[model samples]
Target chain A: MKNINLLAMLSLLAILWSCGDDDDAKPAEFGTFQVYFDNKVGADDITRRDNGSTEYDFETSTGEKFNLSLLGYYVSKITLEGPNGEYFQDEMKASASEAKGYYHVLEGESASQNIKLEQVPAGTYNKITFAIGVEEDGVLEGAAGGVLDPADGAWFWNWNAGYIGFALEGTAENSGQEYVDWGGGRETLENTFAIHIGGWKDVADNENFINNIKTITLDFGTTVKVGPDLSPLAHLVTDAMKVLDGAAIDFSNTFSVHAPKAGKPFAEQLPQVFSVHHVHQSTSGHD
Target chain B: MISKTKKYLVYGWVLFLFWSCSDDDAASPKDIYAFEKPAHFPDATYTFENNPITKEGFELGKKLFFDPILSRDKSVSCNNCHQQSRAFADSPLHPTSIGVDNRVGIRNAPPLANLAFMQEFFWDGGVTHLDFVPINAIESDVEMDETLVNVVKKLNEHDEYPLLFEKAFGVKEITSPFMLHAISQFTAMMVSAGSRYDKYVLEGTALSNEEMAGMKLFEKKCATCHSGELFSDFSYRNNGLNDSFGDLGRGRITEDEADHGKFRVPSLRNAELTAPYMHNARFLTLEEVLDHYDGGMVDSPTLDPLFKDGDQVVGISLTTEEKTSIIAFIKTLTDRDFIAEPKFRNND
Candidate 1:
């Protein structure tokens, strides 16, 4: 009877200790975080697509005027970072059979106006980072479904065997290639400058070309405080002018970069296009 | 019925045990199907990091290489263009590489030897990676002309291939990267460093006075471009085959006018067997190739600087004696052991 009373007293103390620990260390809550990529030609947001009848003028950092027809590129492997090293990663990945992380922020897809990142660990996230294109492993995996799916068209160079990670179709009279007219009243200038920068495979003994993985990281600078009461919305502005800003190859004359040698200049400057313009934060984590 | 089922299970377990033991039965795992990298040869550029070359993977790769199932119509195989007899080059039957639907290839199919040291592939050097070379051929309109997805689907559907793939890679469903890697393992293992010339260099083997003279002649005239231990520096240069471009060659890939008419420097190893020579199979024989270097070179702006001595022609100077001796020396590069390697032959 003396031993039994002692055991009972110990068990009661254990339950009290567990309850005290739960009240002291309450688990943090999490919610969905939305990231929006807003495209712009200078200060003006691209709102109009004037079929072939009208061409929108885009002025580069070099102050050279060119007309753009289509402007969209893939952004993949999105990662979110907290100041205190709190980490949350997405499990889904894009492949030749299925598209998971592949997001093509198209011109008029307000339907997917923002990429919804679900169940982000509830905390103050200072930055967002993502790869500009898919790495070589994804490129060599052949065809995939969704945004990476070639059935969507104009992304893959079938004969050459590579995915065009960053594609910008436009027209310049001085651009030293033939004009591409995609009917719908869509007509580029006499010369079309198609910048398709992508290559993650080596060609033997060619020192003057890019034969390795090309992935540029875009880190959002603005601080975002996310919690259960607040799922922060980060606005990222990507400008096409930044791609050719102080670029090695003058896009004015030698514009079209289909191969690695020509595409290296633009691939180097891919990060300049992205920046976090604003962030919405809420106060709920600290209690 | 239970006794009969028990007997079958015992038999099945025995077979599985036997099958598993065979792979491990070899002397050392690495030595089972060892890759040859000669002392004088440069380090292999194609690193098998994720895809280690194994006996089963190499065998599966060889099977896939020789198998016609990878082709669209089941008529064309990698072996069709890349024949083992001609040193993994085009057979004499194919003047130029012929593909499915009897389609004509643009350039002459080059030989496959010492590819581990090679950085780029193709006459135009369009393909940077050796593993990617098969994809180009498989997808080309005139070649196999099948989608990579379709090829994967077909391979996965096959009864034997999935098991072979499982044996090579643990995955039940095969992927394109594994396919490319397995094939690369087979291609990379094809080392031609055991030639008589190689033995002569390393072991100081006896050579005839004619071959010795030819070696001297080759060093004096041809060694600059085909300099390395592999006999080719693996560079793309315009050897000035023509004043006007029939095919833009490297220019087609690079899109630079300066690169026009340039072709990859073909390795002279086993040159006696691989003919006709040049990108377009322009030369019917090595004698013709020597003759072209001797006199037939046409002046073009994109011509290699080695060919031009300030607007004056600097073609290879060779006499009848020199040519014969050079041919003799070149013949010594034909590695008999590599061609006769029993493991590379069709198992079936």
Candidate 2:
């Protein structure tokens, strides 16, 4: 009788262990946050439209007067920091058609784009982190579905490879009435412009990460505005322009990055050109 | 006896594994061409970033190259004159290519091989790069007679092109860059470095006595300008073919009278295959070409200084036997592998 009971217990334990080995668990949930890019050069300035086009005039600290035309980029690998030091992450890959927005920005004016997250484990989040451009790995290794899909135009469809991160084109009156265009395509990752502002490597690593992270607090039922000012991301754009302006990116050397054999290095000398501004955030109460 | 909970767990694990594996095994968009450098050749100057190679893009380009849709009246394609057997040159019988409405071009179609090494394109060298050469061919009144905008529009209207573009470029929309890149990829892959002469150089094989004698004669007389791994130095030379034609060769592009009657040195590779040679296809056979070199040289102010001497005059003292030997050597340049390769063949 004792042996029979022991055998039955062992069998029951085995059955329980097998039953617990379930792999299909629901993915965790993450909270959503909004990024707002404010293009207001002055406190009370509204863009006036002439015909079908609207223009905004602004000057850089360097006195480079520009009429802003288009300003858009790709944002992926979204993550949020919670109050208890917990973090929730969501990877929303951009489709190819969606990726097309990275090629050109909307004309004149500030805009807010929402990043939706699902199954995010509900928590108090303090920070939002995401990449400003398409990551190298995602481009080199390839991504499926989501925002990085070719159908979304997030990828560099015209070039038959890679993606474009940030495209800013406008007319610059200060620079001899020349056109100011700064954009990086995903075809060659090593040649993509890096926005490193301030400080030498021996002194301080002030290199702005292509992956921009902003810390903000969010309650379970609240809305948070991520970016209303272009200052924080301005360094990236300016640095890219500086690289392009300096004639540092050799078209022949870094033309393709399809494989590792095409060993082209990422642009390192970028801090000499761009400057970064302060990041601000505002929160709204939700019911 | 497994409980219901145990069964559910097993099912869940299976589902999880299935999904994870599926995610991992997701297919990457296929590339157009698997660009492999030949062991005998040097590194290719062309890079992939500007126009990455993909299978679909190459196939699409090949389809376009062989299709008459590029013509104004849908009567000609790039292949109408540049047939494969003739080493991608114009048919010897047709001195000039016939275009839409039976329009005739001024120059004969040159063999399309080893173009990546060329610094300039066309006999006049008007176009500088291979990427831009197709534009002239597609848009010229004597060639395809189609516009880039119309070609893109037609491709967009096609049922198969959108998907083909998506497969090659990861986009459903057809683009000018994608179209050009695809064609360039196909053209770049049309390399011809496998002739019997190449075998003698690479494999240390012996050439026939006739071919050997011909090689000596070529080195003595012709190798000065036609010297390089690609046969032609890609320089414009006044080979004394004509004192003047209505079209004044390189002079038209430079708008300089000094460059009159100058044309790019044609490569001798596959010379036997592409007959009725020269920019105008005036010579019908190797004998005629030799005859031109022997005694039919035209006198002009811009004649190449190399041929100014009596030895280089219209009629060189070459017996019929020497001409035969030189012809035999030229035939060694015919690359059977290049024409027979499936890569250059029509994919569709």
Candidate 3:
């Protein structure tokens, strides 16, 4: 009777150990989500022109003819939300060598437009939110690397000591920019316009200080599942016309906008500029 | 349970003995290269965790500081404007900074010392971070006239710099942040806390009778703006510099009409060596600066209220004797040890 009881006890212990092993076999599910920024001027696709290009490819709401030579904006602090309280916040870190969350989506850079976020918990996310510009937190990190490195084509304003949030450089037909010799092989051509929007400092006591960093949120219009087997890509459209029209920019008068107060209107229009064009749940590979 | 409690007490006692031994080792002294805060001074404002100071990094920064390679034409460097002999301030000959191609800067290059404590940089307080400060000088048309992209490229192409950078930051390729970090490591180590006033505060060293009297008067009158151990409240004030604004000064940065002609209250440390004072290098001597305070001030809309007594703009009521005493006191702030420190010298 004693021998039979010992055998039964040993069998029960083995069964429990196997059950624990079975639970450990399956890990928590995580996946990747791709955010594709499709930049456009109204309904037409954007084709970047040279700095001195006279051929105006786009027209504003006010019927002002212009062509983009350079255009870009920084995006950071991305978050995805679901209807059933599922939330995923992208990690933010600014070290000497890396600025993790900040993304400089520039025109003509095809690889820079596609932002791939990895290690996202498997869930059905319906809404996406992100800041249009590098905010106070990004600036206060002192020195940063990757896209935030000013040495490597980062649009940084030296005197003001902040990154240019959004930049639109082009030649407008009605631009009043006079030709000037900057010396040392640098020149500002006639009819050329450059609008650089920056300044994150917003002191509480100082009312005049402008914080032009803007946040934008867009609904997917349809829920997309994210898992190891399925990866969702959100296609967002950025319309430059919305900013030019919404701000009611007169190309002649409002040509050079490099300051924070001057860029307030342009930054304010950032929310309406970005929209969810479409989303795709691809089984494999990044587009 | 009683035996377990007794065992924990015995373990704690042994650990305490080891901790005490380690504490004694730490108390003996720190390395000369290591950044140590003077007990009298406030905590450093620099973010050390991001770029911790190493011997190699500090040396690289020092090399960069004195190198003319940062300039567009390789004709100017930080040392060209900020010399060590003048306490890292520009020479009195150059009222404002004389940059590359003999191009003159508008504002005076203020002395560089105890920068780790400063919250802002430049006369207008435009730059909030010390790392960002060099970029202004490098990119300024009147100064270096070199773009940061070009500077990084130049450094990368150099034979020794790439390897030096690797040793300093442990990176295979050179980047701007690492370069900036290396510079910060050197500048942050420039802690000028060995002045006579500091010694008097920390070690109870005696000051001359005149200096003591000046100290008392300064505490009574000037301490409102230039307060604390580091000196200067770091507030922006017009100080009745001018009636009209040529350079908007602080207003240019803030875009506020009220901030016109307001510049940061500069620290008085090494004030004796740093001649041609104020934002525009208006005052030639310490006596002239005191004279400006004693009725030579030009009134402005944004003039500091401290200088104003109702409708009458009364600058500080300082007699000639009082001025002499204040100058004597201010001279005590000159740190000979800091200027003569051989480690800061450019060996190459």
Candidate 4:
């Protein structure tokens, strides 16, 4: 009877210790986080025009007028970081059927602009990092579904065998493109320009190939609390003028950039194009 | 002197053992469909995990390969340029590809074999994966002249393709990746490793005296570029084919002046059957190709250094006897079984 009493006392002490450990460190809570991309040209919002429309909405520093028919970029590898070593990385995987952790943010598509990340560990995040183009891992995974599928409107390069990371297609006032009726259902516009920034080869000994994928990190300037009750939204502004004006583009000669070497100058200015506009900590969900 | 019942029991036991051994060795269903890597080959580079080879998937890919519905007006198919009779290369009648609407292709249609072991495709090595190679042919204006989206729509509308796709991939809706993956499953299994040269290397089969002499000459004169068991090292080098770049070759892909006039070194497996060689089909026979290496090379800034000796432009010095022997050895690389395999033929 005395030995049984001693065993019962030890079991009671074990239960008390477990309860004390739970009280000291409660379970981590998770909430939603959203990132909004706002595309702009200089100080005005992007106004997408027709493919061959000549009415220019933007002018370069060299006084070359151009109007965009399509403006978009591939965003991937999103991450949230905090000052206190709190971090969250979005999951990335590609298979024959689906491609996860990739977003094709296009102009005039409001639904595509908002990127929602869920199950983030509750913390105070102050910085956001993302990639502007599909990296080598994304392209090396062979044919994929969702946003990376070419049949489903992925900006893919068939000859070079890679995805166009960033695309700017429009009409320029002094473009060198000429109209060609190829006797089929295909024809080139008279003054249209197409700038496709692609190429993902990074050979160790070869310097001829160009890899134009760029990653950008921005500071929110203020921290926002994230928890089960609080959902945070980060507003980011992407300025296209940094690509054209910063590169000192002359549309007469610099209009067509379909190759990697031709697109290097525009891709070099991508790091400075994105910046954080504001941060909102709200009880309601993202709008 | 043995009893009749005892004799029957012994015969039945012997027959049962014989049947079981043969089934395990040859008649097993799994063994026929499996992608068996040849013992002499290097590891395959295909992403088989993304799309494992199933019997149904292979069948679907073969049907698609033979179907001309992939073209714009159903005028051509992959089989038009790639014929199984010529080891999946074009016949000698058409040096380059003769595509839809009688459009003449700029480059020669290369042979397809040992594709799972390859890292890149095309003469310029632009495509890096086997799955993405078909998109170029299907969308090239001189080739299929059909859009990828339209091809998918046509397949969906076909009465038989939808059910075949469902059986292969277990999907309600047909997609490009699945289609590409199915094609890869068929192409990757086209492993060419049963040649006479393969037997000579693997099973110690003796070559003729002439073939042996040619192989020795080949090792000395050509092994710098065509080094490994696969014959070619898969490098892009301008073999002094032209001085002025009409096609621009690899330079168009890299946009680098140094890479001008460069094309991929093709594998010599089954080279005897795949005639009219080179990226532009410059040579009509193996003898002509060897002659080009000896003296016909023109001078160019980007010519392969193998053809140069301190700017003297000294091509490979091969005598007539050596060239004859090398040709004999090269013919041994042709695998008769691969081209004549009934399973690789179109069923429908």
Q: TM-score per model for chain B alone?
A: 0.90, 0.87, 0.92, 0.91
Which clashing pairs does model 3 show? none
In candidate 3 chain B, what residue range of length 10 has the lowest lDDT sum? B19-28
Arranged by lDDT, best first: 3, 4, 1, 2
RMSD of each: 10.1, 14.1, 6.6, 8.9
For candidate 1, lDDT tens digit of each residue in A95-212?
Answer: 4335677677765666444787777877778777777666665554433456765434436554455667776776654566656765445555555677878765554554554642
Q: Which ten residues in a row have the lowest lDDT in candidate 4 chain B?
A: B17-26
lDDT of every predicted structure (CA atoms): 0.73, 0.57, 0.88, 0.87
- Residue B344 error, candidate 2, Å: 1.9
| Index of the highest-DockQ prediction | 3
Fraction of the real A/B interface contacts present in each candidate?
Answer: 0.03, 0.00, 0.66, 0.61
lDDT of 3 by residue, B32-90 (tens): 77789999888898888788788899999999999999989999989998888888999
lDDT of 1: 0.73
- Which scores greater on lDDT, model 1 or model 2? 1
Model 4: residues >4 Å from true position, as ranges? A1-28, A283-287, B1-30
Residues A141-212, model 3: lDDT tens digits: 789998899988778888888999888999989998989998889999989888888889988799779988
* lDDT, residue B257, model 1: 78
Docking class of 1: incorrect
Off by over 4 Å in 1: A1-131, A134-162, A168-195, A199-221, A225-272, A280-287, B1-30
DockQ per candidate: 0.09, 0.03, 0.36, 0.26
